[model samples]
Target: MLARIFINRPVLACVFSIVILLLGGISAGLLPVAEYPEVTPPIVRVTAYYPGANALVLADTVAAPIEQQVNGVEKMLYMTSQSNNDGSYTLDVTFAIGTNTNMAQVLVQNRVAIAEPSLPDVVRAIGVTTKKRAADILLAISLDSDVNPATGKPYYDALYMSNFATIQLKDAVSRLEGVGDVFIMGQQDYSMRVWLDPDKLASRNLTVTEVIKVLREQNVQVAAGQVGQPPASRGQDFQYTLSTLGRLIEPKQFDDIVLNTDKNGEITYLKDVSRNTLGAKSEDIMSRLDRRASSGVAVYLLPGANALDTADGIKAKMRELEPRFPPGLKYAIVYDTTPFVRESVHEVQKTLLDAIILVTIVILVFLQDWRSLLLPVIGVLVSLVGTFAVMKVMGFTLNNLTLFGLVLAIGIVVDDAIVVLENIERWMEKGLAAREATMKAMEEITGPIVAITLVLSSVLLPSTALGGLVGQFFRQFAVTISVSMLISAVNAMTMTPALAVLFFRNRKPGKHAEDKEALPWWGFGLLGGLATVWLLTPILGPSLGLTTGEGHGESAPGGLGASLAGLGATLVLAFPGAVGGGVLGWFMVRPVNWTLGFFFRGFNWVFDWATRVYGQIVGWCLRFSAVVLFVYVGLIVLTGFGFSRIPTGFIPMQDKGYLVTNIQLPDSASLERTLEVTDAVEKIALETPGVAHTLCLPG
Candidate 1:
């Protein structure tokens, strides 16, 4: 009944297809592109610092208290802590896969507050910092200074570069949409340092405790009151406010601080026993870009955020601040993970296009008519494109898994159209008119089409019910394939019959004269032109790097000449094969029909032979049903054994076109020694084949 209505109203059927295409196209643009869905567990990190404390002391005083408080937070899957020798304690509390990251953080924060009073006084004073962020590092931005022409050294040192990025760049980037947090590697905030001379202090009979007390007292902030005449006894009223320097901003101010006064009326100043200077808070960590002193800013993506868009926003923000950068200072994106994503998506898109083209050619060949090919081609477009709308509604992204499903669906979706079209064609061959054949075909095959769609969808939909990260990974894939299948079934019932009625003709048998027509000269010209460009691209396209140069007195296989020769050979063979076979039928008309006829006859013969063999096997299986069942059971058992032996993982490992190497040294290793080791590592990495760039962060 649905097919009958659409067969009569061909325009309405086309409108339905157009609507699907429009919705799919729009949804595709709006869908976020990613390498994978959010499979990593949500993590909330608690970090704290304790100056002059070793890893063991930090573990006891800081890590223990925080972990104890945060251990059993709601939805928390597990917790891990690291206490570094540099007085840094980091605790990562991981929640279940789908837990709300913000809620987890709040819960962890509430627990930490209860444990704060039990922590050391210094730790409480320093305060613990909590952050919610994805575990992956989206990208890294490096800030380096240019060489000084006069001295042949960097105009700015690593300390200056690190502080500059922390002050100017970090906050701005953190404010951007989709950016969870920004961290400055090798951070060095400016601080006033007092170099106390024990000898001089001993000579003056001033203890270190006395010096600290005087320094703290002198640097304290004072809130001076206003001087007003509001309540003064009659006469001129004048109001004034008094101001005083609260905290010392310069090192010289600390030098004049009075330390102690003795009975002899002798006063000693802080400058007498100590020297003051402004320097970095810590000089333990150093960053380098290609062996030059630099700072690295690592950016993290928020949970469920689009990484490509966030990376672009970070880059644009950097460009906007480029003009304000200090002289000789510049920034570069040293490491980014988005390029792999972008390239993977592009490759999938190419594969999708190739699949569409291959499907169309196969349909044209099997149908033996250009007009008949439109049924399946249109069916594929509508079904696959419409799946995007379903994906958008399901909160799925255009990631690798979903795209893989789409690629597989191309074959599945085309099946519905072929089934309907073949049924209608069979009716037409039996001396029925186009409309009558379509209506009769729909009446007979509509149930089968609907059943096939449901069966395929049911087979895949069960995967969506899986648990945990594996479920998240396969859910989108299953949904995508099933949605496309459903849409294809609808298209087969409605559009396939309508298009067949419109595209087919009502002709008596043996009317070959009217079907045969002259081939257009322009069609041959277009094919020839395309073939010429395709053949010449290997030779003339320098971007292809197809050089005809000799290496070690041997001709390069990938050279232009060899590439062109190979291309020519492929075209010669393929033109007579599947793809070009259709082209020849389109352009050569009756002249090439004989050749196509002979090739197709051979194909039909092989297909028939295979069908006969399959029929014989089916008959044998029925005759020996018990034996066949036993063999099937044995095969199932074998499959289970093989599956148990195979390695299992959440996802296959992909080379993402980059590598990360973590180098650890002994706890007693000096900063210089760490740098020496890192320098050696960086040099080796740079010299390694396929290594394009390297960034070093040594502490």
Candidate 2:
């Protein structure tokens, strides 16, 4: 048996656990942290612009043709399109939840290519591009400005602020590790606009189209061949290259372009008809922060990159750029999804750690010796660490799914080690030597231990075998539990036995070990009451999820309100559980104990009678064997149909703490009006006992 193999090489077992722990720790750092496993359907968006077209025109001319071509693309679940009065078209194509997004995008692109010729000329000129859209943002950094400390200048205009961000900040943030793209919001590029006076143009006998054509023609640059030393062999005289600066780089150059000359000797220049100035391209978006013109970089994370690492990398890059920023320009974190991701992951991690603590206490309570808790605790730690290496190998993240699975697996993993240790202790209590007890215990219990591990594996591994996105969500949880179990099984056969023998050897038995007496009536009552309290305390915190899907009657408020509410709830619950538990203990002293004891004996009597009755029923069925067989087969068939007709849910949908608080104002509420409402809310919140802060984010 494998137990024999491991028992022979106890040092190897110790080394194995140590090595796995080291590797798993390293893998934990490497694994990505995300909010959820990718469960949402991947979406590809196609955008087009038609400068002067209305929404109806854009829908009919720009959106219709593209949607027709992209509709039947591979794995596409559905397509939706929208047209705006500003002459923009957005066609969103959602693919199957687990579709290969890159390939799907390419397919949509090729189809959009086929529709290109059908679109209007202006739409084609403006160009249509596809972008992969994730449901949630990764991070967003605000480009805010401060009053110059030295110069006393106000914040710059939105146009200049956006250009500086696009030119200096966008590329820097984009190059950070794990960042997919950093798109500048409210961005406007440098451009030139020529103010056309229709009266002057009419006086000049020129039209807007003619001016455009003349400018386009005059803006051209021509290249002449270079001349050096008369072709190096033919000409005798040294020659310098002839050159001309043909491109227009100034407003004077543009105005000086000759459009036409009057036959009556009155010459007209382009400057007489129009005025040109350097300015920003037209912009439709306005970003603001602290009542100043603001800009931001919307950072997208790579598909499976570590979010915390990505966020930290971006903030680090931002810090490096901050010192070099232009005077009056500063940066702020407007929004970052990473903090929530970090909190949730850490919360689940804390839950697991708390679980370990809880299990340790319970183990100590049961064993009554700290030394006996070591093997089980060691087994749990080793199994958990070892599972991380497996997670890294399998490309699983340390998200809610995997972490919750580990939380559930704690009991199973510690159970294996606890069982093996308890068996060794039992064998020693039979008056056998430590080594003999270890060997004898393993011989008797190893098969059953292995069987139980296999049985647990059988239950978990099937969830991994399920198909589609739901299956993918469960895959990490199931695989994690399965790997932890396998590790625990190995530890049970090796580490537990080895540690038991090593520690128990040469150890003297205590008085309780030699002669243990049953607990008296009062002692049993006290123990039972304490167990009830122990069970009730932990349940109180998480039981918030079970109260009609809301916490504390109303949805829990954000910030300190939630904390205060939870504390109040614990106090409220614990008071009753404590008082009633004590009362229960007192009542169970004698009369209650007799009643419980009698009831349990009656339960045992019912079970014994059932066993005897089953035998008699079996004999009667044997007399009508054919009829009984038919009836049993019919019941099995009925159960099969019953199971088939049962309704299924993917999983229990917990609140996940994504509560949105809506603040409403009058229908025609201006920005100031909305801020008034916000201020009023904050004022009330400030007056409240536990609330300390409030945040308002406008959509």
Candidate 3:
């Protein structure tokens, strides 16, 4: 009935399909592209630093209090903490998939606040930070220097480069849209150092503690009062504020600070006991690029952000800032994940194209008519492209899983169209007009198409109910295929029947235009046998005492006469076998034809041959119904057994176009020793096959 309405009003059917195409085209542009759907659980990290504290001390003082309070927060799956020997502590709180990272961060921050009072004063003063961040690194930008134009030497040292990235690049990148955070790896901040002389301190009767007390007291802000008072002076025209030296900024100012005065008109200054200079806060870490001093700035992506878009924005921002960089300073995005994502998406797109072409070719071969082929090809395009609209509505991405689903759906989506088209052609061959044939065909297939669509959707839709990362990975894939199938069924019921009516012509009994049924089954078997023998003769001829008379050379018969004789002898031996085998194979296949003709009396020969073979197999099973059912049950049991025995994982390991290597040294190893080990490792890695570059960061 639905097909009849569309068959009468073909314009309405065409309009319906065109609307789907337009919406799908627009949705394809809007949907985010990714290598995979979001499968990583949301994470909130807590970081704190305690200067001069060992790993053991940090574990006892900083980690314990925080973990105790932060554990078992809302939606939390698990939490892990690491206390490093360098007095740094990190706690990662992993929440269940689909949890809002912002809410998870707030909950963790609240817990951390409750533990703050129990922490040591020094650790508390240094401060603890809580923020939501992804565990995966999106990009790693490196800064290095070339020859300086002014001095003909490297423009900046390690400390200057590290601090420059911290001051200039880190905040700029962090403020970019879709960026979660930025970190300056192996960073060193400037601080004034006072190298105290114990001998000078003994001579002055001052201890290290006394000198530290004086420094703290003197190196502070002085809030001096106003110079003019408005309340007392009636004639005062202006109020002047006083300015005084605040915190010391230079080593020279620290050197001149007073420490103590002796008994007889003498004074002690800080310079009397200690030497001071501006230096890095700590020299415990070092970073390098290609054995040159460098600084690394790692950019993190926010949860649910588009990775390709975020990476593009970062690169664009860097290019905009390149001109303002100091002479000889340059930045490179040494490590990026976007290229892999882009290439993978492109590869899937190619596969999808290949699938469409292949499905078209197969339909053309089977239908044997270009006019008939167009219907299924159009159905495939409409079903696949229209699925994108549903994907956008459901918040699905154009990722590997969904694309793979589309590639598989190509074969499936073409089935409904082909079924309707074949049935309509059958009715036309029975002398019915095109419109009447379309109505009759739709009456037969409409129920079967709906049933197939429902069956397929029911099978795939349940995967969406699976829990955790597995569900996230497969949900889009399942839904994409299911939507395509539903669209295909709709097209079969509407556009397919309408197009058939418009494209096909009426045929009278015994006057069909196409001659697809002229060849008999026996003729096909004979030709097939002859072709098989022709192919195998070259290789099996010599083994079967049949040759081309080559080895005899001059002594043997030569020229066309000899070749004809040899060919005649070979045919004489092969003809009888070919004919006998062909006749025997035809007899064996006759039952299949009989079974097919019984069910589909008026269909074309090719369709009948295919359907009859399948029907004969089913007939055989029906004859041995008990044995067939037993075998089927046994196969189901075997499948269950095999599935349970196979090794399983959330996702297979992939070569992501780069590798990460982490090196650790002995607990008591100094930074210099760590650098030595890293240098050796870097050299070995460079010598190994397939390694393009190496970055070493020792801390």
Candidate 4:
């Protein structure tokens, strides 16, 4: 079957190669590249605050009812809730790891029906997370007074500057490519904190609730209907519609806000009792840069945004806006995530290159011929290039796992090429012409190679249908390996045979000119002896030596019989000691590290003592031979168990990025506080050379 392929399908093979190459290139351009997929789906969190409820009470009234109603969801994991002393209840429902969040959310809402009527009306608003909390580091924002001359102070510190900056910065960041949302926090603006005198409130017959209600009502802005527009004045032959609304621009507006009437029938306005003022809100202490009071803002990039480019864009914008900041204040980016991504990619690529070179050198050394090396090399290249195209078509990313798969598969792919090439070489060395050799090689090895490839691919094909985070992490790797292996098989069947027929005649296995060399006398003698052993062993039932009942008389004390008996006894006795030493060594492995460190400090002393001991026993031939043989046997035993002791992993870690950071914080910490701590740590991170972005989240 394969001989026909080698004989007649050369043109088809060439055409297929061209088509695969083009398709792969196109796929490479279009595939999405990410660190990992979104293995975790949408998680909805509901939090309710009850100022005086205990944990037990909160659990029974608020948590239990919600759980029962939200139970029995098809794709839901479970709903878990916790209560605290402050009377807050937070219920978290985690869906099945990869379930579609949008669909699951609808099902969850419908299930919560039975519990809705039992809740206390006093329970504050239930907060549901509409979007997933992302860990993506989008853009880093910095403000510098030195760069923008028109600005008076750090916008982050200046109340007016911060107010205007928030509006402008938020607007600009939204325009950048791949930006999901922009959040600006940490700037405090003017707020009226009414520190009312209890006595004054009693005397005025006013309650706290009444004051709050009037205050809220006075701060309102309502939209009125649009003012009338003339048809003749409107553009494009149509009348335009414009809505009118009242705007509150200053704190003085509150002074004229009317309250309820006094006993004397005069209107009691806000100006009657409390003094109106504009001052900074009652916020926590302001932070600083270089000990000068300053504020900072952060920008989170969209999930799919390229970290490097987004960071560059932010830095460029800062350069343009620096001149607008205040004097004595400076701004700088504390951390960015781009450099880390770049470094990780570079390290993986470098290791891959080194692996390729090593594989090539190995092929050359083992084949010991140029043509044999070329076919497998070409096969490897074709397989890898084809894999890239498949990845592009499948929208897979070039991540750590995927690259690792490629590295591992590189060795296995060469196995097929080697099998085909070796078989063809064997035929050629037997004096077959190139065409005949190619046909014979394919005919003999094609089935085995295809079967092996299929077996390997089947082992990994199940990964594509796996569930949860583990599946998302490993699926791409499995795909890469399976694809590469299949391509290699194709290459072996097609390109390898084709190349062999074209180049085999010119590249003979050895340099000797003789067409046939006669087998040597020793070779024939060895073959005859092996044949004799095979034919006799089966007939004689594997008996090389037999203890026959032909002992005539009792042997003398010093004869051969006594010596053989002593030898057997000695061998039997030595087994126990050898086995005991091995068990002792196995148990002592834990102490080896500390012991080696100790002896390394005194290695010279130990070596000198051993040398003197060896000198004293140099002429003892029996002792020397026994010691050498014992040491060799001990080594062979230890070698057998070496694999069990050493730590085994899929692959050895390449020396590249080891920059992993772990952070911990107490529970109930707000996002604002978390960002504050993260910012401080980021300063230290950015100050260190080669340190890329710092990522932080609440535990």
Q: What local distance difference test score does each model get? A: 0.81, 0.74, 0.82, 0.62
Clashes of each: 0, 0, 0, 12
Best prediction by lDDT:
3
Give the CA lDDT, 0 to 100, for residue 452 in model 2.
93
- Best model per TM-score: 1
Arrange candidates by TM-score, highest first: which order?
A: 1, 3, 2, 4
Clashing pairs in model 2, backbone N/Cα/C closer than 3 A: none
Model 1 has a clash total of 0
lDDT of predicted model 2: 0.74
Name model 4 segments beyond 4 Å from true: 30-74, 78-93, 100-129, 133-166, 170-199, 226-245, 263-265, 275-331, 361-374, 389-396, 429-433, 455-475, 499-699
Following a full C-alpha superposition, what root-mean-square deviation does model 4 have from the true structure?
23.7
Per-residue alpha-carbon lDDT of candidate 4 for residues 1-699, written as tens digits (9 for 90 to 100): 754574566677667766776666555544433445445444555556564578888888777777787777777776667876546676667776656655766676665555667776556244322232234444444333332446664434445434545765667766766454554434555555455556666778888789878876766667553434443444545444555434445556766777788678988766666777766552333333332344455666544344444555565566576666555545666444544554565577688778888998777555544466677877887887789888866657666677778888889998988998888778877877778877888888989998999999999999989866777768888999999999899888877787777766665554322322122223333444444444443444213222211231111122234335543544444444445445554555336534544544365467678898888777574568988788889998899799678887633565433354655657767657765776677578768887643433222
270-359, model 1: which lDDT tens digit per residue?
899999998877777878888778999999988877776677778778889999998989988888888788778778988998999899
* Candidate 1, run of 10 with poorest lDDT: 550-559
Task: Give residue 489's error in model 2 in angstroms.
Answer: 2.1
Cα displacement (angstroms), candidate 2, residue 99, comes to 3.7
For candidate 2, the C-alpha RMSD (Å) to the true structure equals 12.4
Model 2 bad stretches (over 4 Å)? 44-70, 79-93, 100-133, 147-153, 220-225, 229-233, 236-250, 261-268, 368-371, 454-475, 505-699
Residue-by-residue lDDT tens digits, candidate 2, 360-453: 8777556644457778989999999999999998878889989999999999899888888888778777778777778888998888888998
Q: Which 10 successive residues of model 4 have the least lDDT summed? A: 547-556
